[model samples]
Target: MTISALDLAAETKRLLTELGVSADRYIGGTLRVTSPVNGNEIGVLKEHSALEAKDAIEAAHQAFLEWRAVPAPKRGELVRLLGEELRAAKAALGRLVSIEVGKITSEGLGEVQEMIDICDFAVGLSRQLYGLTIATERSEHRMMESWHPLGVVGIISAFNFPVAVWSWNAALALVCGNSTVWKPSEKTPLTALAVQALFEKALKRFVAESGAAPANLSTLLIGGRDVGEALVDHPKVPLVSATGSTAMGRVVGPRLSQRFARSILELGGNNAAVICPTADLDLTLRGVAFSAMGTAGQRCTTLRRLFVHESVYDKLVPRLKTAYGSVSIGNPLETGTLVGPLIDKQAFTNMQSALEQARAAGGKVTGGERVENGAGDAFYVRPALVEMPAQTGPVEHETFAPILYVMKYTDFDQVLELHNAVPQGLSSSIFTNDMREAETFVSARGSDCGIANVNLGPSGAEIGGAFGGEKETGGGRESGSDAWKAYMRRATNTVNYGKTLPLAQGVRFDVE
Candidate 1:
């Protein structure tokens, strides 16, 4: 149920020490966690320790040789077990995520459940994986391409979504038959360890008890930034995957490229929600709220920008303001909290700077409040609304805050133009009642993003959908059929049937 960060940390540290893991001093007298509901700081251990860099790699490398041989079906079974453990640990992980990452309990639970769903879906998807056979004209040759593993995969996840992002990499990579070395967000290693425990137990249940899994199928490394860097750059890691801001993605992407390693970087999103003239006012307002404020607007898929047609801007803005006026705040673990604090002071500062930038750039600030800290004191900046930019400022940059920007658009082409203005096009939306405009956006301008929402709320981006973006959105999509393919290396096997001679075609082999 609901618990304080201090209590959770005390219990967790006790658990870690008993398990032979070392806990480090949490910096700033804060546990590196702030309530999204109020930005309250959790004064607990900020750092975590486990195996060293070499050990992390060796574990992953060892797991790979044996894991790669397991059939896909067995992989599915392991994932299934992983989902169950996640479910069993739901309440604990949810509160842990809330404190460490500044997500409200609802948002934290959403992430926990979504990760569980992703693991379950990934498990079953293994049954449909098959090779493709093709006929070549070269001397009647038949060629087939089968997918294979890329050995050890290293996934570096972000603090914003410690569980979902990790599962995004682990589920696909594992089900595709690759062992992984995971480094969770350094700031929120608590939940990651719980997740790792679940995975460890699941791997044992599916692979060992079933008498089919390899001896070492997976491993987790809980440490600092250096640990993450070491995990990714290790020569033994054949592939690398990261989900975070674009700046960090740049650093890792190049290193992987230099090493000739396969890499996938699902970076940032300045996602937008554009309400067309034909959009339903009531429906559109609700959709914008969900997109704009979901997960305290920390998701890469969160709707950060809102472009409403002048046709409906006047009708929508004030109504949205009215709806927001009643928006709940404070206490993430409380039953009725609507919005939470920024992940931490850094996030709060970023939000404050961005809000001021927007205001200096001629945007208006609606409301700004401070979140309550653990000692029942204020910690983070509350949800805020910035008026449309007369020009443009940090809105172009990915500002992961509960603060959202509202812009007024007048023309059909302008709606698309404004939506495309975002350089980091991770996910965007077009709220319209017309199927024609929605289809056109989906077919034409829609290709720019990894996730595009139409009619649906922006945060409702599906897990089974194709999600990869053009330009700064990073390479190779995660979540969907595309994800499965990205985890594989294709090998073409060809056999010549030999050309049939005219005499051979007319004669029987037995000469009966």
Candidate 2:
């Protein structure tokens, strides 16, 4: 059973109000907000037009001028305050994530926790934005490089991780001394509004504690493709961090490149896992279960394909099938519910179409049936486990649902080939206790994904490591490590203390 539209709307309003968003602020527009958990119309948001999006970019650019001059540690204080606000309202914000995006209770809270984690990470990174000091060839010369803030950072986020992705970019962008303009997914605008409200509270606290902060330090543009285009094409926005499908990246990547602006594109992932003969069956079962079925398999790192050694394929497939049979699918807000509804009916149709194609390709599919929740329009589905003869056909494409395609492999070398065969290079993993196999999997020649792991699933990437992928995944990194460099510009400087005017490399200039 699912919550009624009226109840869901009431709860949504309550959460928003608690988070400091007024009713008139987000409502009174044609942009309808629907809850994926029960297919209920939660509310309506006034969508920003393309013109407003451009204006937002200009405003953020102006804010960047002032924010860039502030001390990095002072900028970090704002992020710290934002982290406190997120922690205080984590429960309400987490529930709002579930209400808007259909993530399970734990995952919903986990998303907010991710935001808080990035803020903590950014707070420390402010003082650590170190530059390099190079040893110069010339006598009495000092050469060094320093990083300075870039202009407006435009962030276009996807629905699966509605709020966390924005925080990933915004937090780092803030610490790096750049202002941010966010274009959240149209389907999940309410969470963005709530987050913006929380950010505003953090900003007020920041100003009270510190001296001043720019007016548009972080701007939220709630709209569809046109708004995203305005952000992408805006000349002032020097960096754009986009997280969505590869097709979206194909459009966004070149558009930024054409204008010589920077882009951090976190695109699609047809992630896979290899189960070796020496792998722990229990651990592999659990890893595969959560990686493929978690978030209804909507995550970018969702395990879409699996390659198992012929020695253990028989042992693991049955266990995986049993696990899939027991997943509880219902409203995401309900505790103990491991799985939740798909984002919409379109996602359900996509899953069915992929299953049909798998069948036509001589694949035997189990599960992938729809569950009847009391809410007629909500889509709850059984996660499908399909056994295929080869890694071809629909298996190569990411269906954005809980469908795991399993194939058998005899050799470790051959399995690696099958693993990197897909166009995506986001995340991959191998479950093996063998030290050589594990080392080889992460070695230069192994799994050609940005993230490769041994005895771990491809999903649930931590924020400490720079997150992104290569090839069609867009070659962009975000959240952690030196990713803050992408939001700032670098300058190399050389100073000569010697009085003599000497030319380097033994070059001589003669004057008459």
Candidate 3:
């Protein structure tokens, strides 16, 4: 297959410039591309531009025809080239992620690495993206099924793990042959820009490496919720993918259904980690800390609810307090800072509400405090642990903060029930040495989530494992060989060649 940029000159910067965008806060004044984590002010974003939104959709629609028309192999080639570029920019991208989202330096760097993996996986797995061929009852008839990319895909990404999640859509969209319009969370636009810039550079190389068509076929539109809503409802946009809250999913899911378009809705999770009496308390606590505090517990898959076996509940609480206490809290840019501020002012507000609500519900706050004084400029908060009979907190209603709720459960069935109580079913974990209990949880409650692990944190998503919540996690599957296939429609070609072929027609009659 031939590979080339849709147009070599059609780089993201070129297009943005032609669209009359200035480097200085390109879209508007309300949306500044400031680093949410480190406080660097070097990026550009469209705060809320109806015009930019319209332009992005129009551009994606134009690119859609050619991108969708491109052969799958050629698309894969471009994605492969982009992956190479991602690898090269790891250091810079890591810094950008840290600056933009306040991700711990290591975790921030890890996001770029993960994105690279996704790119490589998406590109290399093109062969698996296929359809089924079946023989018909009649000698002359045959049947085929294939995957096809929906037109312009609109991806609305959250602030946390900006690089990783953005690639989830762009790489898959390109590999499946669909033009994409990326609307990153306004709070962390820098990471998205850095990732995209690197991707385009790779695409340019891809076009030169293999002569085909323009490879930079995707465009990014940054703005607030209003901008996202515009993209979702756009007539030209046929596919929508959102990584956000259950409430956002509730609103967006119904809206897309009305249009009869495909939507990959990965919503929030009140994820749980069940710690058994026989497991390693230290290890389990350490692992759960990844989700409860990682990225300040802002991810859709953060470990919000922790269920402990009655035998270990008392022992684990203080251990958790000490372990969580060790996290260094400060500016994201500060060297060795363990935690950064929440994504933005709104996220800070959400965390505060969760704390207040948890206290109202008779939950005890063992540790954790709010930093940054409620100012939107730098919304930072310490990791929180609330002791609750149930997983109750501001998070119960959807706080999405850096807080963990500890619940004590004595029964296996009750643990399963507690885990499944949330509307979301994205990620969950179990800390257990008892093989039987682990087996039961895996068998009985496995259907409730996309990824379930034993002795692991809910936040650490595996590239090899399939991720998609049952109810709101989107009907589509991604992150592996199956991802490309989901973006494509399958088709099969049947040939008779005049050779003797068995038909089911006579066989069916005989069976009857």
Ten residues in a row with the worst lDDT in model 2?
1-10
lDDT of 2 by residue, 417-438 (tens): 8898889999999999999999
lDDT of 1 by residue, 1-512 (tens): 23333354454455444433445533333335443333344334443343476676777677777877888887788888888878877777776677667677787788888888888789888786778998655556677998987788888888778888788888888888888887777667667766766676776677556776665466666667787778667788878888888888888888888888888888888887778888888888788787777667777778777887787778888888876667776566667877765666677678878888887888888865564445343344556777775428877888878777888877777667767876786777888888887887788655367667787665755677766665677865777765787787889997766775223235545442
- Scored by Cα lDDT, where does model 2 land? 0.93
* Candidate 1: clashing pairs of residues: 26-46, 36-340, 36-341, 37-340, 37-341, 38-371, 40-373, 373-377
How many angstroms is residue 251 displaced in model 2 relative to the true structure, after the best TM-score fit? 0.9
Candidate 1 versus the native: TM-score? 0.88
Q: Over the full model, what C-alpha lDDT does candidate 1 score relative to the true structure?
A: 0.72
Q: Where is model 1 more than 4 Å wrong at Cα?
A: 1-51, 371-378, 389-391, 497-512
Model 2 residue 388 CA deviation (Å) reads: 0.5
For residues 224-282, what per-residue lDDT tens digits would candidate 3 score against the true structure? Answer: 77788888888888888888777788899889889887788777777778888898988
Order of the predicted models by lDDT, top scorer first: 2, 3, 1
Residue pairs with colliding backbones in model 2 are none
Candidate 3 regions exceeding 4 Å error are 1-30, 38-48, 371-377, 392-395, 445-447, 472-476, 491-512
RMSD of 3: 7.2
